[model samples]
Target: MESQQSAGSNMDNGYVSGDNEAQMLSSGAKRGGWITFFFVSATLTGLMIAGWGWLTNLIVYLIEEFNVESIDATQIANVVNGSINMIPIIGAVLADSFLGSFHVVSISSGFSLLGMVLLTLTATLSSLRPQQCETGSSFCHGPSKLQSASLYAGITMASIGLGVVRFTLATLGANQFDNPKDQGIFFNWFFFTFYAACVISSLVIVYVQDSISWGLGFGLCAAANFIGLIIFLLGNRFYRHDKPQGSPFTSLARVIVAAVQKRNILLPSESKDYYHEQDGTSKTVATTPKRSFRFLNRAALKTEGDIHSDGSIAKSRRICTVQQVEDLKTLIRIFPVWASTVFLATPIAIQTNMTVLQALAMDRHLGPNFKIPAGSIVVVVLISTAIFIALLDRFLFPTWQKLTGRSITPLQRIGIGHVFNIMSMAISALVESRRLKIAHDHHLQEQQGAIVPMLSLWLFPQLVIVGIGEAFHFPGNVSLYYQEFPVSMKSTATAMISIVVGIAFYVSTALVDLIRNVTRWLPADINDGRLDNLYWTFVVLGLLNFGYYLVCAKLYKYQNPEEEVER
Candidate 1:
């Protein structure tokens, strides 16, 4: 008879031996320091994300040449962000269940490379056909619909490929360090390196966007992505690949079928653990357990803390509901925390959109002699903010955590981030209020010309505060969702972080539109043409977000599910 491993035991009976079980995780750790490996991997991946931040800055400059309004650009951004995030859910499911992370990462990287190649072609060739686009634009206007469609198609493919790899790689990189004792510091380095990548990309890509041609900027982004893929591929020899565990969907189906047979319950009264049957090497379900209504604990009926006989506790068997089994297939238990994450992301989206508007409205000294390319400033500010945050996290947060009784949990950081984000928006509102006063005094039709040049400098504090908020929120949210969720649903946890951004985009868009509509009801001079009112809306949003943070802080608590204790 084959000996089976006892349930809940960490021992490696499923594997051939103890050494073989060690192969399951950190196989490469034997050859190198786990911390060094994770830090290196995290830095490489961080550079990839930084490239994206730079590209986000570059795209606005590109769109301006097209003369597209802020609304259309925002819509395109939201669509791209949402579609990429949603598609990754499928990619993660596949990686966790069937293809394995190695296959998923490799194939996804290939698709990313292909997409980048096509994007470069689109950028370089569009300038060749000026007649096809609108007036004042270098490219064609009407007849290039087919070309536009092709570019969008390429973007879709690239988004899916890069996005899937981004989701998988971070977790894979974290896996490089098997020592849970240092996992926090490992992840801190991971977050730091990722932001460092953004910092480097911001500095370099800004030059490509402004000093070089538009074609060159897109081309450079494509090249950077390819470089990222190459680095990942070359480093594969230093990595461990987890074997596929089978499809979550297939497991869910089996659970449902078994639940039906067991009279609609998970882990029937007599069944305390899961089991599988195998004739060859394939996995199949054994006979379902029968249900029995034997109370394991009657503490609810007893007053105070009266205890039952310890032997009686062993006699009574506990049964799990079908809902609990379904939950096992997903990371849905983290949904409450995920819901709070959306609030955090809303400010991030606003920083990109509303912050840009505020910057543009500020006084400018362009005066024909000096011109500030919107692209350069945005990249520099964002990269600087990310770098500063990394430094604080590395040097500051830990020290503070040690001094205080409580370590900075994800929820606490997120709550604290909202405070800074709210202040940033409030600062914007104050800047706009001053700008409006100057406009009204001059009786100018447009404040762009009348507003003081120093107003742009005022927005700097807002950007820096926003950056400070990003430090606390973005990576904290990532590490939090990943650590809290069940191991089986790790990839889903990554995607959940993205979903927060996706939802926040639409929410911010709707709020902006609603505020504009509501303000339109006032006289033209009082509302329609008044940009100052727009800042007020952001101010309101900031205040509401702050209040929301307070509620979340109150509700949020961490628990170690495996240990069954409050952390």
Candidate 2:
């Protein structure tokens, strides 16, 4: 019966056989399809705008509003960015193991709204913040304990809310599609919309925050979060909710446990010796375990007292199905590739935080009348990424396929990203060298907070290069994980990239602290320090990491080589 349903689901083009059709019929329309795309995309746009609004300018906010030191503010921003990326794994686990994505997203959005409201209050009520300092004042008052607590609380809630919603929403949207090609397209658009929304927030909301009023800016963010939540709830009926399977981690743990318990026992010699499943009907399960991880095969070896009369496992902890063991093996096989992304992301993280600090000290005047917001400088990267994603998906990818007689593999895309990332770092080093020369020539090195004569546009080339790299890697990582991971871990798989980013940010933070303590390259007054040397360090690291990635990519054997070839 299970096999029949699985076959039927495939025949129906990925929709589960009975429940989906019944749900569609009962609603008098299809429940999950392109119809839900608009609602999801719109909600994503609103939420992303809300998230980026406060986040992009966070370092400046902490410094100017709360009287935090510049380096301290940057560290705080790094931790906040790390937290926002790190918390998604928890949300993904909850979505995959207990609550569905809809519930997780809805509840998280409400938390985000509450957080934004808190932030707005802190900005509006003078009592909630430190006393205002005079421009160029030698002495500045820091936030009181109570004020500090309030600020941190708001940041914590907002971070949790935004973090949880980011990739879980991606998984939710991807679940609407059945075909792999459609899912790939959705990932592309998902990132495109994400970066585009960030660009808007960086330009519009960051400007409002920097130029107008932080209170008004935060209020706007709160409103956007509210609207996004409402829109998501309105489309509830149209969304196809994947029921939570009890903790996948538990099954994975069982595989390890069973393997250890049966380690003394000899490996199975025949397919009949291994337990497939209770039904013994899944064609997808291999008859024999692969040779790569033969030690784990002991977990599937069916000894006495392993099975009951009804074909159910009598001792599940002591023995698992071959499918479970294989699932664990798949994760093991992909571990190296996943590890490579961490190094790839760390340089980008460092560059992201450092760029803002550089911008604050650079000449930002656009024309005679207006000065660009320091935080908004990152918009160059976002805009570049958005444009490149569209071009890659619609033009470059297809053209490559036509010319090469095969589609561009995800690993290949990631490799391209690595090359571009290295180039971006080298360019950053050269640009910083020029900026430092200008600062020295103008005799501005001794003056703290003095803007150098260098134009901020000089930073755009490196940022644009990094953005182009992101265009290749971000979706490539998502597509690779989604396609390669076990079916039970789909949400978790999409969130893997978040893990990479989260760990990268944390690592970047540590690296920055180490540099500040050990060397004079990243002084609070960067004009007096060797900022170019720091970028040179990143370039070397990027080159070494890229070489490591090449090795991993070379060794990795895709689980579905046939499917890869077909693509």
Candidate 3:
């Protein structure tokens, strides 16, 4: 009876016990340290500062130092950004499927450090970069093949490092906590630290690069990367490392194959006809598959030859359990909501790059002493995002819960983000309209590279609004994916957002190129082009995407509804 009782609990929850559970539990003084958060956060902060230090100023660096053309610089930046966001999927795959988060992060940080060092060398060694190209030069000198190779090698390494660090760091930090509330708190602080790092990099690091020396700026990044890597290594003992269970993706694929193979065979309705396993030794879940996605249920069907002489599942590599089949169904059901986020992210990606271009053309003065760096302007979005994240996490959520007697769901948070994003794009359109009007008044349409009398501050409201939109959507999408995704693919859940952003950026590049070719809306000289039209296009896209999101959200059923809560 004692064994039966224990087995019964196992059959239902499937929660692993013994050392797996023990390793995760927060113990006494020796185990979890508040200082652990400080060390890891510090490490991550250092890496973030190092990363953005160079990246934010990449456009300027390419044009000034590498002597690349403006359109070419923009294309390179988009591709680099896309690559940075895109490869996190590979990192997440490594984390969830094989190497685990800690090892991958450590290895990637090393790569980041090396990249930073290389970039520092590139900045210091004049031969590694092209001669300074004046803005009005008839023919600007481009980077030589050797210089280009060296430059690209460094960029590639840094991008790889950033891809690994992005979501894997979140997964690592969250692993430190067992309680859901603690996990939430960690996420809040995690993103805050991330944004805070970006803010400092934008203001301080970017200022140094623009106003001071690029060599010094690049060297500082190298130093930060070194310190961060060292600190992360030092705190290795304190981390509650989660081990990777062999790839869930492979198992999911196997289920599809098995189901297809068994498609002609009718799915068994009888409870006993399905394989119910408590350690594969006892029954659970009534041995019946859920009715939804019934085609997949065939994978879980038990046949006479499938079991061994002692009732064990023989050669089980080709077959799947009912839970596995259901897990696949959950992914299938959630895919529409997942797909919707790609379009949701597309406008933001385009706007981010375009806003930088807009800043370059506007008067960027704060009093007589200082000129605001063009790269730093987008930090407005980061600042707004950081502020709203704190407000939503600290105040808004609790208040909403108290008034409603229930927390807001991720879906609801995402829905709110869609509205704010639309508002942001509309505001962007209006601001661009004003800037274009000023250009027309000054008769500067034909003047290539003309700085309109319009204050760069005019661009602030749109950025801030988008920042607010990001504050909602970024966390909402991450939280939703983390909650809805299977346990084995938790790292991948975070990476899914990166995946969308990556694809969106690529899409944005295509759109930008298409616009340049087909419409007069985006020419080499943005001052002469109709950027307002582009923003309006995004507004229309946002509305359509929002509508699609609602339909998907309405139709979807949560696999584990109880776990998804706002608070």
Q: What would the TM-score be for candidate 3 when compared with the true structure? A: 0.93
Q: Name the candidate that leads on lDDT.
A: 2
Order by TM-score, highest first = 2, 3, 1
What's the ranking of the predictions by lDDT, best on top?
Answer: 2, 3, 1
Higher lDDT: candidate 1 or 3? 3
Runs with alpha carbons beyond 4 Å of true place in candidate 1: 1-54, 58-62, 127-143, 249-333, 361-371, 439-455, 513-535, 538-557, 561-567
**Worst ten in a row by lDDT for model 3:** 1-10
- TM-score list, all predictions: 0.75, 0.96, 0.93
Q: Write the per-residue lDDT of candidate 3 for residues 56-90, one digit (tens) a residue.
A: 88988887888776777888898998899999989
lDDT (C-alpha, whole model) for all candidates: 0.54, 0.87, 0.81
Candidate with the greatest TM-score versus the true structure: 2
Clashes of each: 8, 0, 0
The collision pairs in model 2 are none
What would the per-residue lDDT of candidate 1 be over residues 1-567, giving only the tens digit for each residue?
011112112222222111224333334233223633643464355336534643455346434544444445555666676566566676778777777665777787777667767766765675522233332343434325666665676677678775677667665655443344355555566656665666566556655665676567667766766666667666665554445555545544444444444452322333223332221233434423322222211111112222234312121122223222433433433555677667566656755664555454455344766545544444444555567666766677768757985466767777777777777767766766676566556665342223344445566666777777777777677777766654555566666677677787777666656655776512222212555565566567667766765675575545343321212
Pairs of residues at least 3 apart in sequence or in different chains that clash in candidate 3: none
Residue-level lDDT for 139 in candidate 3: 80
